[model samples]
Structures are given as C-alpha cells and as structure tokens.
Target chain A: VPGDSLSYPEDLCPPDNFNMVSTWIYRSSFPKKKNFSFLKKLGLKSILTLILEDYPDQNMKFLKENNVTLFQFGIAGNKEPFVQIPDDKISAALAVLLDRRNHPILIHCNKGKHRTGCLIGCLRKLQQWSHTSIFDEYRRFSHPKSRSMDQQFIELFDGREAWKVIDPKWI
Target chain B: VPGDSLSYPEDLCPPDNFNMVSTWIYRSSFPKKKNFSFLKKLGLKSILTLILEDYPDQNMKFLKENNVTLFQFGIAGNKEPFVQIPDDKISAALAVLLDRRNHPILIHCNKGKHRTGCLIGCLRKLQQWSHTSIFDEYRRFSHPKSRSMDQQFIELFDGREAWKVIDPKWI
Candidate 1:
C-alpha cells in the first residue's frame, strides 16, 4: 500500500496494452525521456534530464518551452567514463524537483521503463519502502507491460552488493 | 615510388592475423608498419591503458605497477563509449611524446587498421599532401592483407571532397 505521500503522474494513461512499455525504453540505460505530450497534459512545465545521442527532438522543444534545464551526460556502458554518477547527482535531481514542490518530474528512457524505474526504485529504496510499496507505486501509475527490461540491472544488484543499499522495496 | 621519409614502427604485428590491408581499408588507401608493441616500449613509468584488459599478467605488468591511464574517450561504433578519448586529450598525449621532436610516438588499434590509420592519415591531410602521395604512402607500407580492408578506407577517402585535408602519411 502506498502512503498518501506517494504520487503518480496523472498523464500516464494505459496505451490500450502493456506492450507500450517496450516502445519507450530501448536505446540506452540512462535517463533519456522523450515524447512529453503526457507531461504537457499533466501540466508539467519544467524538467532536467540526461540522455544519449539522438534524443527526441519533440521533447527538446518541450523542454525548451517548459524552461527546463536539461543536462546531457554521456554514458558508454562497460567503457570509458564507465564510473556511474555518485549519489550526489541523484540527490541533486530530486532536490531541485522537491524544492520546487514536485513540479512533476518525468524521468524516463526511450521506453520509460527500466532506467526510469531504476531511478524511482532507488528513491524508494533510500526511503526504506517495501517491494510492495515500490511496485505498487509503479503499478498504480505507469503499469509497465514489460517487466524484464531491468533483468541486467537486477542481476547487477545481486552481483555488485548493491542490494545492501537497495531500497527495501526491491528486496 | 616510396619517399625517403618512409618510416614505420618496428615489431609491426597487427593485433590479430586478420588485420591486413585492402579488405579493411579503401582501394585508394595505403598503410605502413605500426603495431601494438610500439605502445609497450614507450617506457612510461606509469600508464593508464585499457589494453591490459586483453593481456594476462604474464604478458603485462604496467597495470600492477599503476603506470597506465585508461579512461574512455574514442567513439564507439554504436554511439557507445567503448574506448573514448576526446580530441584535446590526444593532443595532450602528442605533446608529452614530443619536445622539439625525437621520440617514438606510436598509436594503434586492432590490425594497425582502420581507426588507427584514419587518425594518422588525418595528420598527413593536415599537411596538405596530395592524394597521389597519400595513397602512395599507404601502399608502400602495407600490402593490404585483405582487399576489403583497403576498400573500407579507400571508400572513406573517395568520399572526402577535401582529400588533402585528411591524408594519413605526413605525420
């Protein structure tokens, strides 16, 4: 059960089927959300994002109009600059969003599933939430059809001792 | 006819047996002797290199000695950062190897092939060398192990409108 504090974006409507989950997240494992019509519908006017190459142009126009500050960081998985960002950058994203009173941030991948879920999942983990709580938050909102998108990340959690710090919900 | 300035790295073994010329380069391309061992002999007391990933301890000790710098910078084919080195950083490496100029400066990737050759070739182009001389430089040094490699690079040359700007032998 999600606490009253848990919030979901009002615009994340079911796209007639669960398969839509795959369409949004595909290219890379960083937070590169695109197609902001949903954000516009939900009245989200500002955002910050990190994305890989060929980010959606429509989203660029959206970010520009919304006056959001998009910080593009490149990641080549298992390659140079391979070191993941410190927790500080993570905190920074949330701090700006929260200070502005949760201006409806949209963290996403091309599919808006794995990496997006990962970031959100980690936030829940930090807050000591239960697996039920985090999944509930996910189910309550986006209702991802594709569950296996995070297979590698889940495997990493087991291998890297990241589970020790993973939010309780993931356990 | 090869020029008097014809020089190539000794121990010019390609990373693999398949790394011959022509098949991997363009029909218009020429290659000279350059190989991986050239890097080991650079005599850096400290070097951060990723090449050690492929070689076992019996083969390499620079890593254990903490004498290699292996940060990612070059472009990965799939827009990933497999081995990334920014342009400015390579210039830095060039500076370290040369003062007024007498030092062995060798660079290579698998095969002494495409990527390595391309960058070196760019140095020649910068010198405003003629395409005739440039192609001559490549042919004199490498026999094009496979016609396809030569075609690969020659294709790149054929397409470049400003051929002189990217010749690969001047340096």
Candidate 2:
C-alpha cells in the first residue's frame, strides 16, 4: 500500500486546528462525524478532552468501537479576570500525557485554541522549551483569538507537580 | 533521561516557526548555531533543505559530527508574478521524504514558510487530506504572509510523479 499512486479518491478532513503536538500526541478541535474516518487512521489509544460538558454519545460510541480510553480533564475556558483553568486539572492532564501507555493521544477542546494551547504550552515547558518558543507555538494554533491570559497561565504553570506523577519510562 | 524531574535548567530554543510535519519529518526556519542543541534532541538522520544557497559551515560541522546526511533541493522562492518553485524539485524532495532511511529528517528553508508550506501541502495530498485541512495548516505556519501562489502550486502539483520514485516501505 505504500508505493501505490497518490490518486486515492478518499479525502480526509481533520478537525479544525489539528496538528501533532509531538510524538504520539495530537491536538485539535472536537471531532465531528466527518472527522471520525480521519481519526481512525491515527489509531488513537486515548483522547484527553478539556471540555466541561458530558461526552457526546456518538464520540463515546466511536471510542468504544475503537477501544480508545477517555481522559476528561475538564476545565472552563479562561475568560480573563473571573474564570481561570484550574492548575490542578492541567497537572492531572499532564500526568496522563506523560504516561506512554495512554499515548497516540489527542487533546481537544471546542475550538482547539485557548484551552488546548495552554495545555500544550505547559507540555512544552515540561519538554524544556524556552518561554519565547512556547508562546510562539501557542500563538500559532490560537491565531487571532490568542489570549494574553492563556499565555500568562502557561508562564505561571509549574512543571514540578506534573513531574511527581509522571511514569519514568515515558518521559 | 526519561522522567527525570521536569526541572531541567537548559531551555531548548527551537528555530522560529519550527514544528513536526509528521512522525519523523520536521519543518523549521534555517537553523542557527543556537538551535543546534535543540535539533540534537531530534536525533535527525538527515536534513532536507529547500534554500537556494550554500549550507552554512556551522551547520555542516554539526551534521558531520552527528553523522547526519544533508539533502539539498535548492529552489528559488515562490515570489508572485514571476519566480516559481519548480515542480520537479518538490517531487525530488518528496522522494527524499518518502524514504524512511532519510527520516527523522528536518526540512527547512530561510523562513520555513512558503517553500516548506507548499512542500508539506503536497505531502498532505499524498496522505489524502482535504484542501480545507491542508490550507488551514499552511496558513497556521505562514500566518501574516501566506501566499496564494504557493497554495496554488501545491494544488496543482501532481503526486503520481512522486509515487514512481518512492521506496514502498517508507510511505
């Protein structure tokens, strides 16, 4: 199947803002029906969602069919002064990400922008990325709606808590 | 080095506009001396460059010391109205990308924007990505300076030609 002509008729539509975050780690907006076939190709072992709502039946069905685990580290969108994504939730999420057994994982929120960006920014911090580089990556996915507060959250997130929970073999 | 506390003091500074294009394929701006240590972590086996210039001495030294091969497919920038990236060069570059032996490869140009974007766009075509998904990724990396001409080039490029030269196992 590898050298077959690239004239395959099937066209894959990845969810909005989808991109690989690193080895076995992907980030994107929530997957819709159309994105399911595309998602199948990823052979995902797990999905870590930041959305606060109950999981949709269809998505749950898809995961059950594919034998994929769900890790919900729900947090509200950072809405400036009043609302903030809890630091403990992101720390717990990082614990999931650092474990290789749950990898080939996708991280998502509604738009795959602010919340996803913040989580990824913190993950980059764990990977030892410079703040400037992490923010640049943050702004790339978030684009016009990039939030200063999310950047601040990433800047302030401490990786020490995540370190305590991670599997040594996976990092 | 896995799961050592995430308190590593050395911050990695990835080159401007750096990202993983796929599992082993990375895209970035022309790497500077400072980005060398960051690149080292990738354990790159080769670098496939699209810049139409001589490789820098420092980069050459890094490659030599690391035993990484260099594949230069120098093509002019896709400036509007006149200059265009030749179709054959991109096809040739695709052949390099399709070969797993050349993998854990880094693909770059001066800014890692236009030329690299077009190249990745075509690779996505081979992967059967929808145009919307492809362009969204293109614009994400190019940002304020995305070009219609480059997108056009990607749309028009044929992937069949690349299939002829690919190693079946790599794709």
Candidate 3:
C-alpha cells in the first residue's frame, strides 16, 4: 500500500523538479512526518539531506522505521563569503545517488532553495546540460531571489573531478 | 516587437491553467499595465473579464491600444445563495472562445479565483474530464479556500445547451 501510485496530497508540497532526468531522483524542501504518507508513493529508498543545520531526531527515526537510508550532506553558510560548500561532500552524495540500491532518492534542504539548488546545478553540469538551461531551471524554482554566487559556483564546478572522485558508472 | 514571443518576466504572474486544451486559452488574475509587456508575449487576441466590480479604465485602454477585444461577463455575489452567474453570458463567452479568430485569449477576475475558476471547471466538463481531476485543479490554484457552489455549478452545467446556443465547428 505504501508503494502504490496515488495523488500526492496537497500538504506534502511534493517534489516537482522541472529538470528531473529520472523518476528515481526527486528534489524537494524539507519533508515532515505528515508528508511521509504521500512521500511513500514515491517509493523512495534513500534521502540525501543538505541541511547545513541540526538534523531532527523525528526524521532520523522516521527514515529508520520506514527502512529508508539517510545520507546527510550540508554546506556551511548562507551567502557567498559566508557560504562554504565542499566538493568532497557533493561527490559523496552523488556516489550515494549513483548506487542502484539508492534508486528513488530525494534531495532536500531547509527550503530547498540555495544549497539543494547548487547540488542540482552541479548535477546538471555532470549531465552535460547547457549553462543557460541549468541557470534557467535554478532561477525558475528560486524565483524572486536567485543567488549569483550559486550560479557562479555551478559554472566553475568541475563535474569531471566530482565524477572522478565518485567514479559513477552511469555518468 | 509587441507581438513577438519573449520570455515571460518572473515578476508578472503568467497564466498557468491546469486544464488548458489549447495554448490559445490562457487564465490569469487581473493584469496591471506593467504586465502588458509580459502578457504581450502570449500574443492574446482577446480577454474574458469576469470581475463583479467595475473594470478599470487603464485595462480597457490598454486592451484597445493593443488591439485586443474584451468580453466582460460578471457574476454577482460571493458565496452560495448570493452568487448569481447568468447562463446566457457564459454561452456568449463560449461562443467568443469557440471562434479560433479570438484565440490566445485570457480569462480573469479579481484574483482569478471563483468566477474564472468556475468557467474553467465548466470547460473541463465540456471536455469530459473527470470531476476528481477538475476539483484537484481548482483547489490547487484556489488553495486555503475553495467554495462548493462553484463545483456544483460546473457539475450541473448543460454543455449541450450552451453549445446549442454557440454552435461553433470547434468542439
């Protein structure tokens, strides 16, 4: 029943990434236990969190109870000069995502705006998508406020280096 | 350049109807003159105004200058037992929409909530879409408050009778 395809409840704010290349990969804001019923429909086996803050115990317990794995990756800071996203963590998260066992994964942050956006921006780079398209997708979701630093970071990211570290066969 | 296709500005809330069968049929809230540049991108030939209150002079003047036709169809009141939407006006509006010449049309009320939503609900019925799907679309856009009368109105509408009055070659 948990894995059955059903309409996502309105409260969940379910993932609807415009550039999702696979149904197995999802991007969303931080999900609560109330969202679990609807999220269960995604059949997610892993969660890649980029909170850069304290992880709630309830969420950790929920994931364990649901038999889902947790992969926490956070970048310290809010804006540029303050923001500090390490390449190694992103590569590690990508490695987790690449593992076939972690199919149907969700990536999330506080509001799924900046940090999550950067990770997705890097993923788009790895997929060989154009810069214009990547920035468009990022800005569309993060409208009213898009950080130029995130754009700059994405543009400068060496996805080849990340892939080299992760050694993902799919890419 | 006024009619040329351009990227819709992020500030202007562009039309995003869930049940749009044709790119020509656009639905949105009342637009300010500032929205004209972005709205122009739609290449709209006409606007269907359903505001119960007086239509602003600026909007009318803007429409005239842009060479776009206006079809004002207002329904009185807010909730049930008060709101009175005339059947004939709906017939007329449908007639206007049926004319391919008046395509790339936009339908709007104050917030594009009740009246515009009702018309869309009725259109969904004419298109033979499911009630569940119709309500889902309505509630998604009109979240926090969705009236039952609107749903009832759409459910009871005789599309055949409306079609009989407007009998265009298009479905």
Candidate 4:
C-alpha cells in the first residue's frame, strides 16, 4: 500500500490545526554515516535506507558505521513509495526499533522526498498517527499532488548516468 | 516490496520444506481451524484463526477453544508490505514461516494470497532465508515474475482503491 497518492499527500501534509505526536528528521542531505552524530542529539536510532543504485558513495560510508542497523529496500532510488504517510505511523515503527533505546535513525532515499515521505507515512500509520497530521507534511512541502503524480513523482528517481537504448520516448 | 518478481522458479517453491512458526493469527474458516487442531496434535501451535472475511458472521470453533487472534486488511489483507507478492518468493515465505519454532502465524487478506505472500516474503527476508530459497518462492508464486525478471516486476502495484472516484479507473 506504499504507492498511495491522495490520502498520503494529505496524510503527510495536514493542516496545522491537527494534533499529533510526530517529528521529522531531514536526513536527505546527510549521507549514510555522516549524520549519526547529529541524530544522536535528537535521540533517534536505526535507519531504513530506501536506497537506489545511484546513491552517492558518501551515504554508504555512514551505513558502514558501528551503530546503524539498515532496513534496505532496492526500489530503484528513482522510484518512490506510493504515497505520503502519517507521523503517528512513524511513531509506531520507531517504537519497534526505538524500543532498542536512543539509537537515532534516518530514513533516506537518494533525494529524500517521495520514498522517505512514503515510508514515514507508512510508519506513522503503523503507529496509529491521525490522518490529519500526515497530510500536514505534504502541505508544508507543497509538492504538486497532480494528475501526473505517479509519473511526475517518478522523476525523483532519475538516477541513470546513461540512457538505455530502449527508452521509449527517445526512440 | 511485496510485488517483487524474480527470475528463478525455485524462488517460489523451496525444496525439503520445513514447518512454519505462527506468531500472528486471524479468524477465517472453521475447517481451517480444524486443520489447525490437526497441526496442534503434531506439536504445532496455531496462534491465529483464519476467518473468511468475505463472510463476516462465521465463528471459527477452534478459536473459542484455542484463542487465536483475529484481524483483517481489506482485500489486500495482511500484505501491507505489498498488495501482491511473487509466487516463488511467496512459497519460500511459507517455508520459512513453517520452519520457525512454535511461531505458526495465520495471515490473510480480504481473500488471503496477496498480503499473505507479501508479508511472508518480508518475514522470510527478515528471518535470514537464503538467497536461493528466497528466489525459489518468487519463481513459484508471482505472476509478474512469470513474464520477465525486470525492475517493473518490483514496481507492479494495484492502484489506490479507496481514493475518490474521479477517474473511471478509480471505480
């Protein structure tokens, strides 16, 4: 159910008036091991790395660090999860790994918008996050929730350095 | 990751299968519960009841005696990780679950296969099932894998069902 489009947008980005116990850790810029130190400050632990093949080598370095446990999924870094997720869900999933205590986590995709948003949303749902708060993140990000959401969102996955000769439009 | 399609047939069907452990349970069918009783006689503990959600009023008799957990997940059932999983991957999933010690869990979707397969595969991967065994289940069960072992196999998804009926396809 990760590919959700509409509910996810609203779920990831809800109106400010919503009441929820959610937090966002923007580890998009921090390659794998680099941010563990900062995450330690936030009291976060573990990481669910939504890796695409083209992700920079820097991120891998962090993964090699001692404290991080990886939940790696090769969804072609270019492609993102189906939709945004609620914060409470994140709370619940974190609760799963968080119960481990003070292990700072970072959920990252190459660019860290769609896949990370979707994973966090799913995690929020797992934690029983209110639907309203999930939508708040989407509203704040202000990414288009468009007719072409799938294809447009797919653009975040554009990681290839070389085009395959079989690319349809190129033909 | 439930919709994963693999290139190998063995991925779907593992050889020399082991019994699955049941950690989760659901309420579905009476006869199935009887089957659970039969398994129990063989030293298996079925933790979940399998109740056919399509027919809600049904009470699984064994559940009253054994106290199995009950749950449902729309048509997709328990396959939150994925709506549909590959055939062979799913088969391996079953094997891994069975081999687990006293962890015989019951999982189902609205019907049972899609989510069951997805969750099973996830459990298998999480449990450290071998690379060969994992591929075996994917080949044995997944329809998408039957076509081509392409990235699209992983990308295949059933569109959002609960979204507003804006497009004819949404309905």
Q: Which model scores highest in DockQ?
A: 2
Instruction: Decide which is better by lDDT, 2 or 4.
Output: 2
The TM-score obtained for chain B by all candidates, in the order given, is: 0.38, 0.94, 0.84, 0.40
Each prediction's Cα lDDT score? 0.34, 0.90, 0.67, 0.35
Question: Which candidate, 1 or 3, would have the higher lDDT against the true structure?
Answer: 3
Among incorrect, acceptable, medium and high, the docking class of model 3 is incorrect
Residue ranges of candidate 1 with Cα displaced over 4 Å: A1-38, A54-56, A71-88, A135-171, B1-171
Indicate whether candidate 1 or candidate 4 has the larger DockQ. 4
> Which of the predicted structures, 1 or 2, would earn the higher lDDT when compared with the native?
2
lDDT, candidate 2, B99-139, per-residue tens? 88898999999999999999999999888899899999999
Per-residue lDDT over A48-159 for candidate 1, one digit per residue giving the tens place of the 0 to 100 score: 3444566567656666787655544322222124444334444444344333333434444444444455545444443333344355334322333435333323223321
Name the candidate, 1 or 4, with the larger TM-score value: 1
- Give lDDT tens digits, candidate 3, residues A1-171: 211212322423233321232347777678876567656766779988887677799887878878888888877634868666787888777777766778778888876677788888787666554577577656755654688888888888776666665543553
Ranked candidates, highest lDDT first = 2, 3, 4, 1
Give the true-structure RMSD of model 2: 1.5
Report DockQ per prediction, comma-separated: 0.01, 0.68, 0.03, 0.03
State the lDDT at A161 in candidate 1. Answer: 31
The clash count of every prediction, one per candidate, is 49, 0, 0, 78
Maximum-TM-score candidate: 2
Could you tell me which 10 consecutive residues in candidate 1 chain B have the lowest summed lDDT?
A: B22-31
TM-score of the B chain in model 4?
Answer: 0.40
Residue A86's lDDT within candidate 4 is 31
Error in Å for residue B70 of model 3: 0.7
> lDDT per residue, candidate 4, B4-117, as tens digits?
212112211111111122222221112332234333433324433223344233334554556543332323233334543344444333433344342434444332323434
